[model samples]
Target: MNPAREENPTLLDGFRDGYSVHLDKFDGPLDLLLHLIRKNEVDICDIPIADITRQYLDYIKLMKVLNLDVAGDFLLMASTLLHIKSRMLLPPDDEEESEEEEGDPRAELVRRLLEYQQYKEAGMVIGARALLGREVFTRACPDPALSAARTEEGPLEVSLFELVDAFRALLARIPKESFHDVAPGDSLNIADCINEILSLLQDRDTLQFDELIKDELTSERVIVTFLALLELCRLKLIRIFQNGEYGAIWFIPAVAPEQAGSAGEAVQSPV
Candidate 1:
């Protein structure tokens, strides 16, 4: 797919999209629902289904925008959310059945979510192992610069969803009135953007994400730069870290050794 520089770009969560590649490696729909629930800091037992449904569908659109395979389970879960939402909207029955837990529209979903959370927590790997994945690129050795940067900054590693959230915030800071039209003569190139990012990462332990396009805030510019960042992460050339949740994000050069199989062998965090 071509770059998302057109006037009518596909948008979700404030980010534009044009790529059409399958990201089968990502998590499932329930995992995404869990993410949104946690993100909103709402009670899983009494989920705000309407709001959660909206956010869940937004994620589905985003997955499609990224050309990811929308697994059957995701669609099934979407319908389930909508069904629960509709049922919740109906007035409670006049009978005492309404007072029973079985009559609650959200009961089943709450049950599932609680069970899933238990399984997820049970399987959670400890420490850096939870932070690393096989899809990421790796190096055979560690770097003093990375160690030194960590010593001074003490930033925590972040997940891909967190990165997307930050990117959305970045786009929101730009005003619609300041938008620039992309001319064919100034087409965006992913390869060039990747090289530009590499140059920025050189001789540095951690690079500020916003600095990549600090000089240019156009939508096209931001979109291309983020895409490049995603590509780099996918290739395992760099890993992202944040000072804290909702804190300043930093990019650090990293490598995974061929024998890197666990936290004991690798240093980078997982997505």
Candidate 2:
């Protein structure tokens, strides 16, 4: 069989360009803003533009610092937020103030968010209904032999933003290190890092995200390894899970039988 790199040349190109973290599947900038709004427990219609903008920019900055690929849409949202913020700072005329909610700087954004939220929730309901059978039918009694493999329930699903938040917290607790480019070496390339992670996963069911990069003190190395973890997620060869809302995050090898069957075989990772 062809190596993963052969199957995913664009992913390899991403590596050469120093961007290996794929964020597209995690939703877009608007979704992120919604997440932030919900996180802060603030009213969506009355978003604190300045505070949310700062937090959003901070996330973007962290992604850059970690070498995670940031799409242009995120930057565009940042600018939009700034524009709204600037407009709000200006004193309003009686005519403008008398205007309906439409006159509010956040009016349009609030409308979009409310609409998008409804659509998202409706979509989730449909998706859950559609997959209900898969959830129920797939839970048939397991073989006595494979019973030891407790992954039948599968790993706890995690989101990209959660991973980012976890990484940010991880960085805060660690000692400061001078960030630099991670030179590709005999033992430090992403492909090797991927294999290292797979090897570690093989010994146990799950690994703490901290355990993967604890030895790699440099920011670049940690970033690259984290990207490797993201790559594994992209490939569906592993799963990232958090214990609870603010619990420890961990990684587990593929939960599917087909993927687990290949645990004994070499994985073809992007070179």
Candidate 3:
């Protein structure tokens, strides 16, 4: 016998009194249910509710013993399983009983579990394909126009995650006091706003927040312009700086040819 298997012989045992000894590996209630179905060698099309219910409760007990942080979702599933089990156990009423109705009370549960399992397997397959694609790839050919554009400006340091976070923070600060109305074609195009900001930065080196918003505009346009600034920052084509508490932001263009090459090199190198 394998040493690992010998060390935990009871781990392979099938469900007894509706419970199994080997459910500790599961991360959630669905995982535990899947393990139980597999261990019993039972068809997912037809599940025995009473047996699974007892097994589920047994695992819950083990979870409590191990002091596992069981989520409410897990408890809710357990309650559902128990309810189905009780329904199965109750004697059928003479008037409601139908001979045509076939299969177990837990059939719906089995169907859902099987569907979830399929989706989970598909996700794994997709993830594996993504990993393979990342391993064998070619560098994109350099664009001379893009290079020429970068040569006119300096580099600025910023991260994509930071830019996204900053945008989220700006959205959170929008006042809920008065609802702003925006008609069709009223909202400014994000791309146009990006170009406008780029033009201002190109002319003045840096643009203050109030100066950027000085043009007559609705709140919706302001929000769109802010998002545009964030997108530019995310692309590493712009820099945003704030001085102190309640201070206005300064937006500046960042364009450097060598910096792009260095970023590409960094991605190619192993950590």
Best by lDDT: 2
Top-TM-score structure, candidate number: 3
What digit string (tens of lDDT, one per residue) describes model 2 on residues 17-103? 576655434477888888889978999988999888877886676567667789998999999999999989887767866765457
Q: Kindly give the stretch of ten consecutive residues in candidate 3 with the minimal lDDT sum.
A: 262-271
lDDT of 3 by residue, 143-190 (tens): 333333343345333344544555556555556542465456744677
The global Cα lDDT (0 to 1) of model 3 is 0.62
Q: Please identify model 3 stretches exceeding 4 Å from their true place.
A: 1-27, 94-104, 130-271
* Candidate 1 per-residue C-alpha lDDT over 134-218 given as tens digits, one digit per residue, 9 for 90 to 100: 4343363144334433544457688899899989988998778767654557577776777676655565566898888789887
TM-score of 1: 0.39
What TM-score against the true fold does each predicted structure earn?
A: 0.39, 0.39, 0.47
Candidate 2: C-alpha RMSD to true structure equals: 22.6
Q: After superposition, how far is residue 143 of candidate 2 from its true place, in Å?
A: 38
What are the Cα lDDT values of the candidates? 0.71, 0.73, 0.62
